[model samples]
Target chain A: AQKVTQAQTEISVVEKEDVTLDCVYETRDTTYYLFWYKQPPSGELVFLIRRNSFDEQNEISGRYSWNFQKSTSSFNFTITASQVVDSAVYFCALSQWGAQKLVFGQGTRLTINP
Target chain B: EAGVTQFPSHSVIEKGQTVTLRCDPISGHDNLYWYRRVMGKEIKFLLHFVKESKQDESGMPNNRFLAERTGGTYSTLKVQPAELEDSGVYFCASSQVGVSSYEQYFGPGTRLTVT
Candidate 1:
């Protein structure tokens, strides 16, 4: 079974500050996919990023970035110069190949204070 | 394109009552999925439908949960004799066939409150 762990339950950051959310996962499968999602106050989930197992490269999309390190079984997401809109509950998920199911971690609620 | 849509954004039912939730997938999407998030827990998969057929339903909680995708356009999930533990937010998502590597578009979930 694949399990994702996000240790941070809640985080608060002032506007313009950078924040990193830590996520660690355990999976026996050699190949799998990692994903990040954001659920705002409205309770609608929005897909953030998806990284395959083979790719350990860090990714940056605008002010959002993700670091995937297979050696530590960690996939961390960071937001730079964060705005108030960044406040939401973020979840890290894992899925194995040939399976449509995504195992999600308990989300981390981030509050961006202006 | 319009994203996946779910009906009755919220539902309240008494214990032992039967409730059905509906989901309309994106146009031309062949893959549809159902997931739920209970209080203080992560979202868990309930089932997956590829067109009119149920591709995988291993995550369904029990026999009381029945899901069907009729005509391959929309799907319905029926929970009989709902328990208090069944209260949660149910989400529906859909992905286009052969599209950009299984990117699923989600709908605003239905919050089921079983009392």
Candidate 2:
């Protein structure tokens, strides 16, 4: 069985502040993939990033960055200088290689107050 | 190109009522998928379609749900006699073949409210 756990249920921060959302996963498979998605108030899910198990290198894209630590079985996302438009429900998901389904976490609701 | 699109952005129905949700994948994508998220719960996979064939449907909750994709184009999921527990947001996604990235384009989702 595969599972993704996002401990933070909700977080609020003022505009221009940085926020980090935690994600932990459990999987027996030796090879797997991890992903992060953002769901805004419109209810559409936007794919953010995808990381493979073999590559534990940290990734950064503009104001968004991700830390992948195979040692901790954790994939954390950080948003620098978050704006009001960045407020959304962030999800952490896992999938085994060639697997048909994606296992998702409970998600973290982020609110950025301007 | 347009992304995945789902019909009836929102639906409200009583218990034992029937409802149908539709999804139109990208113009040339061959992989289609369905997922749902109940209130306060994690999103779950319902099924997957490779072209017009059902690749996997192990996550479908029960027999009351039926899905079909004709001519390997649009897909439909019909829930006969929906129950309270079936109330949730249904999401549709699609991916192109040979895309090993496992990245899927998602739809806006259809919110179903069962009374």
Candidate 3:
């Protein structure tokens, strides 16, 4: 069984500030995929990023970045200069290779104050 | 391309009542999935279908939930004798292929409120 853990329940940050959400996953499979999704107030989930087990390289997309570490089984997401619109519930998910199921963490609610 | 769409954005029903939620996947999508999120809980997988055939349903909570996809098109999920614990937002997603990564598109979800 694959399990994802997100320790941060809620986080607050002022506009233009940076915030990092921590996520740890446990899986016996040697190869798996990691994903990040954001659910805004509208209740629609927006796909953020996807990383496979073989790729440990950190990724950056404009203000959004992700750090993937296989040793720690941690995949962290960071928002640099986050704006008010970035306030949403972020979830970290894991899926094994060739598996259609996605195991999601509890999610972390990020609130950006203007 | 239009994204996946779900019917009856919200449904309110009493216990033991039967409610059916509909999902129309993206045009040409071969894989469709059903997931639900209970209040204060993470979204959980209910089932997966490759066209009209059910590929996996291990995540289904009970037999009260019946899902079907006819003619390899749209799908329907019917809950019989709905319980209070069944109240939550049910989401439908579609992907072109099961092996494709990060290609699943989700619908707005149908909010089921069991009274």
> Fraction of native Cα contacts kept in each candidate?
0.68, 0.87, 0.47
TM-score of chain A of each: 0.98, 0.98, 0.98
A49-95 per-residue lDDT for model 3 (tens digits): 88989999999999999999999999999999999999999999998
Higher-DockQ candidate of 1 and 2: 2
DockQ of each: 0.72, 0.80, 0.64
DockQ of prediction 3: 0.64
Model 2 off-target regions past 4 Å?
none
For all the candidates, what are their Cα RMSDs to the real structure? 1.0, 0.9, 1.1
Model 1, stretches more than 4 Å misplaced?
B99-101
Which tens-of-lDDT digit does each residue in B1-115 have in candidate 3? 8888999899999999999999999999989999999998988989999999998898999999999999999999999989999999999988887456345778889999999
lDDT of 1 by residue, B1-115 (tens): 7778898899999999999999998899989999999988989999999999998899999998999999999999999989999999999998876634367778889999999
Q: What overall lDDT goes with each candidate model?
A: 0.92, 0.94, 0.92
Determine which window of 10 residues in candidate 1 chain A has minimal summed lDDT: A95-104
* Error in Å for residue B94 of model 3: 0.8
Error of 1 at B5 (Å): 1.1
lDDT of 1 by residue, A6-106 (tens): 99999999999999999999999999899999989877789999898999999999999999999999999999999999999999999887676789999
Q: Which candidate is the best by lDDT?
A: 2
How far residue A25's Cα lies from its native spot in candidate 3, in Å, is: 0.5
